[model samples]
Structures are given as structure tokens and as C-alpha cells.
Target: MTQKKRIVIKIGSSSLTSLHGEISRRKLKRIAEEVVELKEEGHEVLLVSSGAVAAGYRKLGCVERPTALTEKQAAASIGQGLLMEAYSEYFLSHGYVASQILITRTDFSEEKRYKNARNTLKILLDRGIIPIVNENDTVTIDRLKFGDNDTLSAKVAGLVDADQLIILSDIDGLYDSDPRKNPNAELVRDVKEITPEIEASAGDPGSAAGTGGMKSKIEAFKITMASGIHAFLGKAGVRGLLLDAANGTASGTYFTPAEKTLDSRKQWIAFNSGPEGTVTVDQNAKNVLTAHTGELQAEHVISVSGRFKNGAVVRLKDENEEEIGLGIINYSSEQLQHFRELDEEAKAIVDSEGLVCRIDVPLPATI
Candidate 1:
């Protein structure tokens, strides 16, 4: 028997929407059936699905997807319920329970809330329930939005520590060039690392119903791979695609990082926490920080930029202003500056547990 695995599958709007830009029951049912099969095979499944705005725009009397933030939010408010009803009904028919989980960027930004969300998902998955996740688009402001479900799915996979992240899209797989513009473009089967050449090959969104393109998917892969999770990108609606993906036999682009992977706390510090200030350290301090030999000392701080409170995330920079890592500041920027001027005795400015170096993966952009 195949080993049981925890899997997170993300289906984009384009895959679930009909040509009329509305949710397709046929597509939803097909996906539900596949998920049921996976569950029956003794694997845990979590779904991150997109299509709320597309599913409700017509009900809002719009001819096309709404561009205005308020309009989109209104559409999502209406569509999210409808989308959940469909999923719940379909899964119920297959003797499985489906639960909805609406998330905002703020949920992950706050450490307490992030841990709570992870704990909740763990309970649901352990009880054999499929957790259906999506951005809380109805209430999320532009600044707090996840932008697309592609990245949200990757983050969710990392949050749940899934064995695999399967992203089903309109395209078959990653290509060496834009397949639409270049008919002879070749599909890349396996990728151990994302190179500049691979990033250059990604293209824009292929469908009006979808927000994420190949570029966003590549970024998502970087997150998952760095988290030590294997991922697959392939065409939606392919026969037994989910099973094939779990079994490592799927015909799609596969991303597998090198041996090392970040721990949960490091993943949070690297991807979710928003830096509130910059902390510049001299070369000696930089060496100690990078070596993970000791905690940062106030005496090592060259300068502190921006205002932030204690326990807030801060960017650690070298004297040359190059970003080296991120850490939770033990003192506020003002306090650190005061200590620098006073030339006081050495004091710990950042504990070792709160620091995450950028040597593993690029730090997430600040909110």
C-alpha cells in the first residue's frame, strides 16, 4: 500500500469557472469525486479553492468580473456562501464533510492568530474533514489581501506542514517559453532550484477568471520548496491527477528544494512577519549573527532606523546597508538608539530563537 500523505490542493478560478464566467457544477463535482477517492485511499486532503467573485458576479448583475474593490468585496460576500454550499453538498454526497476557512493576511501576520489557525486546521484534518480555504476577500482591505489564492495555498501548505502541494491550473506545466506565443515551447518536468532563467520563462495570467499567472505559481513554489514540501503544477481535470501527484507520477513541473528546510518558527519569521524597522550592525556583529553563535548585543548595533515596539520584527542589515536577516527586536528602535548613544554595557538586543537568516530563502516583502 502507498504511504498516507497530507496533501494541499489549490484549484484556481479558471479551473472551476465556466466560459460564461460562473462556477461550473460539473467541474466542482469532478474535483469533489477526486478528493473523495484520495480520502478513501487513507490520505488527508485540504483544498484551497478560488472562484468567489466569478461565482457571484452575475448575481450582482455585472457583465464581467468587478474591478472596483467594493464591488469585488460585495460579489465575494455573496459568492463565498454559494461556493461553500456547493462544496458542502457535493462532499456530503460522497460521505465526507467539507469545512470552510476564510483567512486574511493579518491572520498570518500576527503570531498568536497564525498558531491558532494552524491548530484549528490540524483538528479538522485529524478528524478526516477536508478544510476548504480561501482568502477572506469580503472584508480584507487592499493592503491586507493575499492578492491571489496561489500564494495563499502555498502558505496554507506550509502552515499545515503538508507532504505535498498540488496546484492545478489551466496550463499543463511550466514551460521553457510562453507556450501561447511559442508553439514549440517545451515543458520542464523537474526543477531542483528556481534559477533566473526559469523565472524569466514565466508568463502573465492566461484567463480572465484568474488573477495568478505562472509567475505567481513560481513564487509559490519557492515558498513550498523552501519549507521542505514537494509541489506539482499541472492542468486541471486530468484523470487521476491528484493521485498521480501524491504518488509522484504526475506529468507536470515538480519542485524539490535541496536538503535543508526551515523550521516552523523560522518559516513564520521569514514569510509572515512584517518588519517594522531596520537594525544595522557592524561586521563583527554580522559575523556573530550569521554564525548563530550568540544573541545580538546592543553594543553591536551601528544604527537603528524607523520606529517600532519591543517584540516587533526588524530587518537586520550589515553596515553597508545590505539586508542580512530578520529578527524580533528585544528593544524598541528608540531604546536601541538611546543605548547606542549612551555606550552602555553590552546587552542582548535580539534573542537567537527570534532570528531567521536570509541565506535559506529570500525574505518576504514587508506589508
Candidate 2:
């Protein structure tokens, strides 16, 4: 079997729908056609699409974004149908099958759900089906939301270990500053690093239907790039943008990956799962974790914050709050406290059964 290269393409609401909040069939067809061409080239493709709310609002006879959550949900409920119909029909014409996968932020919030989503997506790809993904706006709360499709696309890219994440916006590429305001703002063709300084150059959200703008795109780029997935932010209307991006053209601001694909798992661990709790370890604990040794001992811990059940993931940090490592805790926060009081033999008995009760001496004393 040939090694498959995976690509994630995200289209902004502005790129998919008209300024008047209607789905543009012509635009959708063009985008689908380009994607079909990519699939013909034997690359696995996943599309993260927006424009559901915009489509829903138009169908419901509303001309503006709804303020109420129920109204927003209603819009999404109505729009998701219209969006998938278009995608399914278009792909069908091209002799390709497109699968609609509506995911909520909750799916990626937990490990099991995230793994299930990944496996499902993999099955779709293996069957030579293009998976069209959108966030489940109808059922998600603001706290469990991806905020916008940009972040959703990046997370999806990481989940699939995509080789590249192409973000299609209305702009040709990201500029050094908001070109609309600063006429002197230069078009940055390529971005090697996404520093806070570079991020400050991004503009605000430009469309009422779209939640993310250049700023969010930059954030997505930084995230995907850090996960060893290259990200390209470019204009969507260009006739061959997708093809160009896939073939490695000097188009848009390309953020190169800094790590290997295997390293992305740890990067995902570091960035995705919010640590359940923090373990403030003494100097000795800090040294052990930094060395990437085995389990941490109870004697090395100074304090534990937040309730963490056994086998829960926790952050090991120094007294200064700098994170040293993240690992599954051998004992819960409450259990570790009592376990630490045991003597060497007693502690060893508990530790030998996959517990941590031994404490190593800390590093040099700080004056």
C-alpha cells in the first residue's frame, strides 16, 4: 500500500456564503471540484466547512445573525441540512462520496470521544470517502465550543496527522498589518515562526457571518505548525488554490512544522488536554520529571492543587509554576498526602504495586 498524505482544508463562512448570507452554489461547486482533483491525485482530504448559520438564517427568513442561543441553534439546525445536501450532491456528480460528520466541541474535549472521532474519520478516508466536518452548533455550549471553525480545523488536522492545513479566506494572504487600514502594510508571503509580535499584525474579524479573521488564522497556523502540520492561509476564489497548495507552491503564508508526526502525540497531550490538576513538586521531584524518569515519588511533592483521581493526568511543575512534565498520577491528590507519610519499606510496598511514595533530595538550594 502507498503511504497516504492527509490534507485538511478549511473554508471560512465568507468564502462559502455570499455577503448577503446565502450559500453560493458556484463557489461550493468550484471548491468541491478542486477537492475532487486533489483526491484524484491520491491524497486523503478532509474539509472543515463553515456557513451553516448563514445558510440557516437565509432559509429561516432572517437577514442577520441571531443573538439568542436558541435562535443560533435553530439557524444551525436549518443550515446544516442545506450545507450537506450541496456537498453530497456535488461530490456525487464527480463520482466521489462525501460523508458528513458534524462534531461538537464535546467530542474533542474528552479522550475517548476524541479517539472515536479520529477512528471514524480514518474509516471514512480508508473507504475513499471525503469527510466534510462542521462543529455541532445546535448542541454545544460556549464553554465547550471551539469558538470558530479555524480552531476546529486545526484540532482536526492534529487528530488526523494531516500533512497540511489550508485555510481559505477572502484575503490573498496574511499581511504584515490590516491592509484595509494600513495601506503600507506589506503582504507577508511566508511565515517561518508565529511569534506574539507577528500575531499582533493580524486584523480583526471582518465578516458578520464569520467568527475568525486573520488573528484566528494565525492562531490556527501556530498550533498546527507546532504539531508538525504545515498551514497555509490563502484566498479561496483563486482557480487553483487547493491544487497549488497541495503541489507545494509559493502561495500564502506557509508555516512550516517544527516536529515529526510522531512527536505530535505529545504535543497534542501538551496542548489539547487541559491538565486535570497541578502537582507542585519540590526541587527533587522537578529534577526527576525533567530527566523523564519513571513515576514520581510522594516524598518529592510539596503540595497538590485540585482533585485528581488516580490515573488522572496532571502537570508536574516547580515551585515557580513552570511545568516540567505531564504524566498519569500514581495516586490521587488525597491519597498522595497520606502515602507520603509512610516509611521506606512501607512506601516501597505501596510503590511496588504501581505507587509513588519515595522522595529524592531536591536540587541545590536557592539563596
Number of clashing residue pairs, candidate 2: 1
Task: Spell out the clash pairs found in candidate 2.
Answer: 284-362
Q: What is the lDDT of residue 188 in candidate 1?
A: 94
Q: Residue 280, candidate 1: how far off, in angstroms?
A: 1.1
Prediction 2 global C-alpha lDDT: 0.79
Alpha-carbon TM-score of each model against the true structure: 0.93, 0.89
Error of 1 at 144 (Å): 0.6
The reply for model 2, stretches above 4 Å from the true place, is: 1-4, 260-264, 293-295, 340-367
lDDT tens readout by residue for model 1, 1-367: 9989999999999889899988899998898889998999999999999999999999999999999999999999988998999999999998899999999999998999999999999999999999999999999998888878889999999999999999999999999999999999999999998888998998888889989999999989988987889999999999899988889898998889657788788778778877788888889877876776766766777888899998888888888888777888778878777776662333343332343222222333211
Q: Compared with the true structure, what per-residue lDDT tens digits does model 2 show for residues 132-236?
A: 999898888787788889988998998888888999988888888888998898878777777667878888898777899888887787678667788888888
Clash count in backbone of candidate 1: 0
Q: Choose the strongest candidate by TM-score.
A: 1
